[model samples]
Target chain A: MSTTNAVELRNVVKRFGDIAAVDHVSLEIRDGEFFSLLGPSGCGKTTTLRMIAGFEYPSSGSIVIHGREMATIPPHRRPVNTVFQSYALFPHLTVAQNVAFGLEMQRRPKDEIAARVREALEQVRLSGFADRRPRQLSGGQQQRVALARALINQPEVLLLDEPLGALDQKLRKELQIELKSLQRRVGITFVFVTHDQEEALTMSDRIAVMSQGKVLQIGSPTEIYERPTCRFVADFIGETNFIAGKVIENGANAATIETPDGLRLRGLTPRPVRVGEPAVLSIRPEKALLLAPGDARAGHAFAIPARVELVSYIGSDTRITVRLNDQRTFDVWEQNTLSTLDRDAYWQPGEPAVLVCPPDNALVLTE
Target chain B: MTLNALERERQRRERRTLAALLTPGLLWLILFFALPLVIILVYSFMTNGPRGNIVWQFTLGNYVDLFTRSIYFNAYLRSIWISVLTTVICLVLGYPLALFIVRQPPRWRTVLLFLVLIPFWTNFLVRIYAWQIILANNGLINSALRSLGLPPLTLLNTEGATLLGLVYGELPFMVLPIYAALDRFDFTLMEAAADLGASKRRAFWRVMLPMTMPGVAAGSVLVFIPTIGQFVVSELLGGAKVDYLGNLIQRLFLRSNPPNWPLGSAMAMAMMLVLLALILIYFRTTTEEDR
Candidate 1:
């Protein structure tokens, strides 16, 4: 019922036969915000976007777009447009005709349609290629045409279903910035669906991470990556090293878990945990630092004495595998800040090191 | 210098290979098709003797006769009209049927396309005779009408029956090409059109029809070319009541007394020119769409 939201799905469920493709899901997408549904294939993200576009009707509950209920509406009647993953540009029409199609269907004046089509094509930077057929254009150019074709309508909400999934890495990166800025320029709410976590983290104002037809978490990129509340979100968002232990103490702000070796680990808990419950302490590889043994690094909550088993020097960071006291292999990423090729400057195998676990960086998560 | 010689030797081998691969098809066409067409073109201008023989004297009298005679002129018009009408009807009926088949599940699509091909298993002449049995005064339809206490109307040997037979025979040609086009068609374009605010009907006209036009042109050529030159349907179904170009050509060559082979050759050449024009137009339109 809130008009401020560009799109609202309230307990929506879409079932194909007896299996639920999209389980009961509720979401409120803020007007003029770039929201993304991030999930792997078959996670119901595309189905949810299709329901909002009115291509698929929900089996239960309601979908409201700009205060209008849209379960029974067809895609054409809905005040929204989708940039399909395949670009789906009409092969028969020229670029200009394709961009002008929505205006033509609205019965707009021919001169107006022509002007707007020119402006829209220019917006996509395809002004010089108006008369060319779609087959003649390159894939990136075709994708831009698809964007212009949808954006020319200026709908209440623009839905993009993995539009950049077909582009090469360089082009995807270029268009990611272009699309984010274009959303800002047009000031239209965009509901983007993508399986690429880095893409969602880079472009989305807020992301809803889905799995098995349910939204596991909905937060900004930093919030989802840094402070994941559940085990799935913690593991799915980034590379995380987990320590399985039973909860020894549950407090208001943090929880403590004891490993079988009687080593206690304390971490911030986003959700409440009951004492004596089995839980996992999730720590990202980048958050942990590796120091020489007996270094006594200040500001470190807990330091475990371990031996560096393997070391890999990537350009940005050096990934080190260290063995903990309980024989569990822990991954630690040390940023390569210094410019040096000296072999002595890096950690070598069998070097005894201390793995510093920061108090604020780790999260205690339960299933 | 050695590399240059090697490249030259490779090019010679390639040329020989190309000639070897093309020789059979080239020889077949020149002997069976090109030679007959040249003979037809040559005989179209030759004189016709009193006893069904080609005379040595070269003349343009057959061409002049074809242009001036009302029967040939009317037959040309009627044949063109019937062929065009049949192609149009096949297109209108076949597009929907092809779309229906394409929309089915993969298993059902195979089964439905099989059903379309099942009629081809029967002989074309037998199917035309089947149509005759269905359309005759004492045939299936008329017999049913008679049993219903209704008057048995004349259904056989009419233009409608002839048209029905032609369309029924040529409809598969139209449907198969359209089905192939629809199968290869990316249906996501329909969803794209819908997302662009086009109604389902508008989407079909703007996107579906134009995209599948190559198939339409191909099917039209396949149907029209054969239907225009066809004599059996009109001969058996129309009972020689209407004189089409095919029937006129047949009568001049074989059926008429002291048959006029030169006139028949002239008529066949004219029909070929008309079909050549149609095919040229078809190619022009399809290539323009590609551009």
Candidate 2:
């Protein structure tokens, strides 16, 4: 990707009367980046997307798109097109006509408009649906038509506002793959807005995790999932066990915290070194290993004595709800790669086990 | 065999219930609408007696007289012209109002609709007379003009006055249907249009206008047909001066020395035919959107 940012929001704020829908939010969406604004509903992700699309103007600050200031620019005049959450296909128009609407608005040659519209439809794998009305198509087909309509414009930035949100899980997965590859082939900047963290992690190169109208962290999926900077970021992205604690020993590369029940947790950290401060140890269930009694220990792995509160086989993984000796509960996810045919040897409810998670896997956050 | 017998009994009972459900509406149409139309048709063929009573003799004279008279021909044309004007005015005013109402917050939408419907609480005739007071030369409007030291223009008993009254009376008819269409409209399509580089004006024309057209068509039909047959507004607001079909029909039926029941019935039949024809044309133009 080029050095130029495709879009930039400089401390943008949007207020709905007394409430700030987007509050002093600043971010850079690089050119050709599959950047996503990931958050729950009413988190200002969609509002930020709308502001970039020029459907909404920020109450304060400014948005610049492709080196041009987008302040006061109407949606149509901006060099960006959005695939709305509802798909928003024009019901009166045929699929081809809807795709051609933008080029025709710009008064392009009829032949060019027709050619581009056909190409767009083909890109979305909807070539034969050109003459059909929007209402005549299935929801997935209509969604493809919406994508084709926006893409046909060949705008600088393509926005998608939870475009796959309404689809069924299987259909959403299919579209996620299709959309990611489409973005790749087009090589256009995509600023997707979605509440589904899994969808964001799957499709986007970088995600901006947001909450309460503010961006908490912006990082790659691995970075975000592995080392969330705050409790909300750690909690929002995936299932994590947050054990409240006080920092006992702080090192340059690692920190140890004493928990409420007097259990100490040592974890990796690149943040500040400070002792006697409130902290939290974030551990993903997948990263925490469950070892039956008398199992050989990895020298660097921290082991905790716990009893299974709940045990359920979930095909890919066995989820064990464990209550620790410290009187705190934590969930440990064990991949069921090993044969579970020996039902008697399997960890039953109330069975004792050692929760062995590597120290490096834990993230100690002092936020 | 026992199950089959029970199923047959249930089907018979269900059929009886269905018949019972349909009877009231069918009976009402027969009693009120179909019977009145048949009586009007019969009256058109009968001769008028010296008094207001109908004569038993069958005659084609009423139809013949209606066709031959310029006063009746001119009156029909005038009413059609006035109705057309009123419908057009209503459409022009109602469309933006419907759009505005639909875009308002959900709480204000009901309040705006209530405001549109509030005028219906008063009797329609009483409302027409209120318009007369507003339009009269020495009434509220002209008096305001006179107090401003401006020359008081003739306001009542004019074509403008009649047109204004017709529009005023029929406006709610137009607004309601258009509002209903807008209420069911999905605004996302308009946003999509704008996102695809259509200006506000272009988006409205390309998206908003076409989708809401069914509403306009329904509203126009509602306003046009009734406006053509209206008599009271023309009488009060036009000060009985306008030669509209409704005023002319009223004169022929009630004010003549011998009430021309046959001639009036003939005129009414023709007016009904015209209304039916207009509706037919409207239906022809708008096939079900099906989209």
Candidate 3:
């Protein structure tokens, strides 16, 4: 991604009647960057994307696209184009006609419109299917046509509202990679919106995780997954096992928390955690390990004795659900490699085990 | 063996029950609709007797006379022309009304649609009489025009009054279907067009109109078919001076001495034929897009 900012939203707020659908969202998307708005339904991510596309006007703030204020501009006049969630391909028009729509609106030369339409179709890998209507194409092809329709305008910013949402899982994964590569090739700032965390994580250069009309965090995929600032973000971005505890000691870069069961745990603190403050210790399922009951623990290794209540083998990894002596459950995922147990030797119901995780891998959150 | 036979008998009995339940509506149509049409057909070919009863002799005189007589031909043409004019005008007026209704907020759409149907609930003849008062000389419209410093234009006993009555009577029939079609219209298609660079006008013409064509056709048939056969509106508003085919047919059957039933039957058959042809043309035009 380039350092130049292509689109900027300055304290934008959108209200539908009394409800603030988008509440004071401010973000800047860099030129050529693939940015995603990740949230659940009613999180106002789509509303924010619409504001940038000029489909919706911000109630209280300005939208700057390529250094121009898009407050009064309509969607058609904006330098941004949108690929709607429904694809929204003109059903009555042929594929060629649909793709040529933007060009025709620009009042381009007839010959040039035809040539560009052909080129756009080829770019989307739909070369010879121009005469067919949108209804005749498969969902993936329709999505490509939607992409071509927006991209042909050479827009400064392209807004995609769940473009792959209608596709099946297999097609969604295939298109995710394709869309990311397409965004890179086109070199235009792509503002994508999706509620699927994996889709956002796999494709976006940066993701803004939103909930209840407010963005909880905006960070790179690694940062969002590894260093989420809030409970919502930590739970939303990935799986986490949270333990309620009080901070017993605070060091320079790490902190120690004592669980209600009197188990002491040490973890690196991304944020300040004062001693005596209540906090939650978060650890990823994959970061935790299943150890034998007799294994010795080190100073930085936190281990808790538990009973394996369930073990599920999910292709590449085996997930074991363990219930601690204090009645709290924690999940541990082990990669299915040679070093792990064979399918027959995996944990059984009520098997005694110890859940161990490195101290540095534990995340501390103030709830 | 007896039980198996009884079970099979039960299945057959249930089938018979379904047929018996459906027989009444089927028989009703055959008696009230099909039988009358058959009678009209048989009477159109028979000769009218001295006492206006149908004679046993088969003759084409009534059909021949219908074509040869200038009065009958003119009346038929005038009714057809008026119905066509009314259908066109209703389409032009109703489309925008439907569009406006569809564009309204969802909660208001029901109330607005109800407003369109309220006038239809009143008795047809009573509604025509109400219009007669409104369009009459020194009536509401004339008074309004005079108050505006305009000359009191003559409206009653003219073709303009008949056309106005036709449109006013059939407007709800035209508006509802169009509203339904437009209300269900995929607005995303229009947005897609606008995004592709279509001006608002182009988007409306290319996307909006084609999608709603079926509604337009249905509304046209709804307005045209009834207006063409209507006698009450013309009799009340046109003052019986302008003889439409419906007025001619009514006069022949109800008022003429000895009741010229054969000619009336022939005229009625001709009207059915015309309506059938128009409907066929409409269906053909609409379905051609599929191919």
Candidate 4:
């Protein structure tokens, strides 16, 4: 893939009267990368996508697509296409005609348009269904037709606004994988917008998690999940347990924090933490281990006494919820394997348990 | 078995009660609509007597009189031409207004649509008279023209005045249905067309216009059918020089010597038949287009 940026937003600001729907924000998406804008509803992710597609204009700043500033360009004049959330296929036209529409609009040769439409249909694996209208197709097929319509234009960038949100869970999962593969095969810059973090994590090469009209953090899935830069990112991308603590020692790569319950915990610090500063230590549920008493070691693990609050068996794994003396709850997963359990020995309610999570697994957030 | 038979008997009694409840409306239609149409059919065959009453002597004299005279044929042709013209003008003007209303923001769309209907709330005859005053020789239009340094032109008592009245009176009828159709129009289709590289104008013609055709058909029927039978506009504005089909039938029934009742009945029946044919054609074309 080329290292050049395909699309760039430079301090873009969009406002609806007094309300700033998209605040001053900037981002650059490299060509051929499948980038996702991940956020909850009303977070201005869709507005950002619309700005990129030229459906909306930024109140300030500039959007440059393929090195050209697109301030005065209309949607139809822009060399970018959008796959709308609703698919938005033309009900009156057959799939072939819909796919050929862009080519026809460009006034290409009739035979070339037909050939390109056939090729696009084949690329989306919808070759035989080209004769059917959008209403005649199932939801999945209709979505594919919409994709074909956009892709056939050969736009420099394709903007997708929650394209898989209308499908059921299973269909959404299937399409997520299919869409990722399609993006890879086409090797085009894709700017996808969705509120589902799992969907973004599964398909995106990079994700920009946004909230309240601002981007909190942007990184790869693993980096975002393991090392979230803020409390919101840690909480939004995955479930994280926040424990209030005060910094006791600040080192080059690690910091020692004293928890409220008089426990000193050591964690890796991506940034410097001053001694005596208050911080929040975030630990993922799966990172915590359920150990028998006396199995924990100092400096490597912090052991806490708790009681099992709830246990749910989810086929391949069991989730155990434990409550501390302060009444704070935390979840730990126990994989169901031959050595672990034989339909018995599962922790039930009121049972005492020890939760042991490694110190390095905890991430400290100061803000 | 007794309980089952009792339930069946109760259902039969309920059916009878439902039928009895519906009988009044059914009887009213038969009396007012069916009975009058039958009476008109009978009257179309009878001759006009010396005392301006139907003589009950069956003849085809009225039908023969319609074709044998040039004045009646001309009046019919002129009425058809006027109705066609009014329908065309309404379509051209109403389609854009309806489209504009539909494209407004949701809150403003309701307010604008209410404005469209507000003009219709007044009495129909009062509105027609208001138009007559405006189109008169010394009315607002001529005075405005004169003040603008343009020569005063006589507009009333002309075909233009008749058409102006027809268009004004029927504009709401045309706009409402077209507005309804355009209101329900799927805007996403337009975006899809644009994404496919269509210009704004091409998208409008290819997607927006075709989708709103049902409204056009409905508006045309609503405007054309009523304007064809309108005598008030032509009579009040046409200065008694023009003789549309409605004026002919009105004169024959209420003012002509010997009443000319049979000929009036024939003319009324012919007008009704033409309206029926237009309605049938509209329905057929609209249904086929939908498919």
Candidate 5:
């Protein structure tokens, strides 16, 4: 991939009258990257995508697409297309006609338009459903038609706003994989917006996690999930266990925190933390390992004595809820790696155990 | 079998309920609507007596005179031309107004629709008289011109005044249906069109206009049929100078030098058939997507 940016925003702000829907968000979507803006509803992720597509303008910042400042350009003049959440297929037009709309608007010759439309439909695997109206197609079929319609334009950037949000779970997962591969084959820069974190994690090359109109973090899926720099990012992405405490020592690469009950825990400090300041230590549920007390000291891992409160065996993993010595409850998911039918093989409730996690796997985050 | 008997009983009850629902409307149409047309049809084939009386003698003279005479032929053509012009003008003026109203915020949309409907609060005839006061030679525009020391042009007692009055009377009919269509329109489709690189004008033609066509067809029918048969505007505003089909029919039936009932019935029948044909053709041309 080229190092050049396909789209860039410099401290963009969008306000609806008195309230800012997007506040000082600046990002550079690299060329041909499948970038995602992920957050819950009302976080301004869709608004940011709209500004990139020229549907909504930034209230107070510069937007550059391929090095050209897009200050006054209208949506039709912008070299971008959008796949709306509703699909927005023309109900009156057949599938092929809908896919050919963009080229027809550009006044291309009839034969070239026809050929490009055929190729676009084939790319989305809807080659035989061309003559059907939008209402006649199922939801997934309509979504593919929408994709074919937008992709036929060969735009420099493609904006997708929760395009799979209305589908069933099985269909959504199927489309997620299909869409990611389609983006790769086309090699077009995609700026996707969704509230589904798993969907974002599975499909995106990089992600921008937003909350309340501000971008909290931006990184790859691994960096975002494994090493969130802030408390919101850690809490928003997945299931996390947070223990509120005060920092007792700030070392070169890690910080140690003491809880109110006088239990000490050390974790990696992804962001700066001052000594004696209030902070929180965060660890993912799957990352924390539950082991017998004798196995805790084998790898220089930090260990806390706990009693198993509850054990629930799901097929893929065993979820164990444990109470720490300081009286805080923590959850740990142990993967079911071996096939076993014996009931006595699993850990029972009220049993003594140790909760251990590597220092690098835990993060010390600031509010 | 018992199952067959149950199905038969269900079908009988459904038929009874359908008949009960349709009885009143059917009776009303047959008595007040179909009976009058039948009377007109029977009268058109009879001879006219010397003193506005219908004589029991079969003749095709009225139908022949309707087609062969210059006066009746010219009146039919003029009425059609005037109605068509009025419908076109109303569409041109009302579409943008409907679009503008639909685009407003909800509170403002209600207020604007109220303004469009405000004229209906008064009697329709009173409204036409009000137009007469505005377009008269010594009326609103001429008075304003006189105040500005400009020459007062002839404003009333012309075809222009008649056309203006018809358009003013029928504009709400044109605006309401188009507004209803636009109000239900999904605005996101416009964004999709623009995102696909279509200019605002092209998007309007390709997306907005075609989807909203049902409203246009409805509005045209509402305006055209009424304007074609109108006589009050021409009489009051055009000073009874020209004979529209409605005025001519009125004279034949009620206010002629000597009443001509057979010819009047023939003329009315011809006008109704022509209108029915035009409406069918208009709907067929506009609704290709439905097929």
Candidate 6:
């Protein structure tokens, strides 16, 4: 990723009559970057990607690819290609023909077309399967064919609309890694759209978290994971415990919040919080530790009382759900790193426990 | 070994059930259709009676005259010409309309498809007759032209009129099949093509046209077969100017001054041969991709 902007959208808005499928989205995708538009279905991530690919004309504003304005140009005239989620391999063409379609459209010679096709199929590791029909290939092979077809065009940017969405779990994971490495090898900017948060975090150099046709945050995986700007981002990206509170003391870098149950908690904030304003304290499950009474007093910043309601033994971690004194629930994820220790057996349901977290790790955000 | 034996017994019982289910349709076809075809084949070789009836005497003269007679041979050519024209015109007109209908919203698609089938609800002959009222020189169209002080166009009793009637009669066959193909068509392929640097026109030709070829072939066959042997449209619209294969066949069997049963049956057999040849040629020549 570099400072050079390969693709830029300027306050682009797209409306399907009354529904704004993409609303005032403006973001710059860096050169050679794997940028993701991540959100739930109908959250306008796909719509945003479509607008950039020129399949859709934005209702307002403009899109520029490689510094050229692309607002009125049709998809065919644009200098970008897309891998449709369905693979969309031409049913009439063999795998070789499908990959060579763009070059043939450009009027390349037969000799060059053959060489480039072989090279493209080689990149996707499908060199031997040239004559096979698209229907003759398995799902993963078809996906690779789609990728090869788009990449062979050598556009300034490549648009992928959830390309691995239709594959099985194991195949999807395998393709996720393959696709990321493939993007790096080609060094062409990739604008990937997916609703799967884990997939986005795993593959994207930067992610544009979206909801309801609006971009919520644009950041790296660690930034999005540890320092989310809002409660929605925190909850959507991973499991989070939202503790309802009101700001009792505002500060430049840190603030104190009074929980509804009368317990006071302090946490760091990137943005200033006004005193007496309603807020929510966001904390990740793994950050919240179950204390053995006096074990947390020397270092932990805050402590609250809770009764264990349930304990789930996940292989890598032990998850415990505890109900706070005022009936609000809290979740704690304890890593089962100690050999020969079954943590689920240690935490009895209905037993009283203390939940503690380091102050710097908690995120306090205004609702 | 016991499991294999049990599976074989299960397969035997399933075959018996399938045979029982197929018995009615197979019997109906053999008794009603096959028997009539066999009788017609036999009748073609027999001699005509003294009073325009079958005499059951073996003769080859009818078959000889079938090719030597110019009127009968010419009718077959004319039928081929008219059927080809009808198929082409129906395809040219129906494709865009079917493409338009498929793009409609799901709710509107149902309504448009229903509209495509609406003409079938009325009696077929009654609807054909209604075209007579509309296409006549003194019909509603010419009358409207006259009221506008425009010169009235000759709209009926010409080859153009016959062609128009055939095309109109077969249009729905073209539209419905193309529509069905477009209904199941994956539209995203068109987008993928465009993204691959194909212009809108190229994308449509390479992707949309080839993808919908099955529907086009089905619709063409539907329109072609029926119009080739049809006498009604030419009879009503041709006004004695057009004598198609069907008109010639009817004259042989039903409207002959003294019925030549063997000759008529020979003409019928010749027509069936032409029809069979056409279907074979069509299936052999078509370029649909094999699955």
Select the stronger candidate by TM-score from 3 and 5: 5
Against the true two-chain complex, what DockQ does each candidate achieve? 0.74, 0.76, 0.47, 0.60, 0.83, 0.74
Candidate 1 lDDT by residue in tens digits, B83-131: 9999999999999999999999999999999999999999999999999
Query: Which regions of candidate 1 deviate over 4 angstroms?
Result: A1-3, A291-300, A337-346, B1-25
| A76-117 per-residue lDDT for model 2 (tens digits) | 899999999999988888899999999989999999988888
**Steric clashes per prediction:** 0, 0, 3, 0, 0, 0
Model 4 agreement with the true structure over A76-166: per-residue lDDT tens digits: 8988999999998877678898888888889999999989999999988999998987888889999999999999988999999999999
Candidates ranked by DockQ: 5, 2, 1, 6, 4, 3
Chain A TM-score of prediction number 5:
0.97
**Positional deviation of residue A70's Cα in model 2 after best superposition, in angstroms:** 1.0
TM-score of chain A of each: 0.97, 0.96, 0.95, 0.94, 0.97, 0.97
lDDT of candidate 3 over A1-367, digit per residue (tens)? 4666899889989999999999988898898899999999999999998888766788898989878888887777878888999999877678998888888889899999999999999998999899998889999999999999999999999999999999999999999999999998989889999999999999999999999989888999999999887778889988999988999999887888899989988877777889999988889999988887887763348778899999888888889899998999999998887665456676788989888889879878785
**RMSDs, each prediction?**
2.4, 3.0, 4.3, 3.3, 1.9, 3.3
Model 5, span B1-291: residue lDDT tens: 999999999999999999999999999999999999999999989999999899999999998998899899889889999999999999999999999999999999999999999999999899888887887789998999999999998878888889999999999999999999899889999999999989999999999999988888889899999988889999988888988889999999999867999999988988898889988977795677576
> Stretches of candidate 4 above 4 Å error?
A94-97, A108-133, A271-277, A296-299, A302-309, A337-354, B1-18, B39-70, B105-107, B143-151, B288-291
Docking class of 2: medium
Please give the interface root mean square deviation for model 2, in Å. Answer: 0.7
Per-model interface RMSD values are: 0.8, 0.7, 1.6, 1.3, 1.0, 0.8
Encode model 1's per-residue lDDT on A1-367: one tens digit a residue. 3349999899999999998989999999999999999988999999999999888899998999888898778999899999999888887788999899999999999999999999999999999999998889988999999999999999999999999998899999999999999999999999999999999999999999998899988999999999888998888887999999999998897999998998889999998999999999999999998888768683457877899999998899899999988899999998889888896867989988888888788888998
The lDDT of each candidate is 0.92, 0.88, 0.88, 0.87, 0.92, 0.89
The sequence of per-residue lDDT tens digits that candidate 2 reaches over residues B206-270 is: 99888888888899999998888888877787877857778777888889987887888888988
Clashing pairs in 1: none
Considering lDDT, which of the candidate structures 5 and 6 is the better prediction for this target? 5
Better of 1 and 4 by lDDT: 1
Per-residue lDDT over A329-349 for candidate 5, one digit per residue giving the tens place of the 0 to 100 score:
999998888888796967899
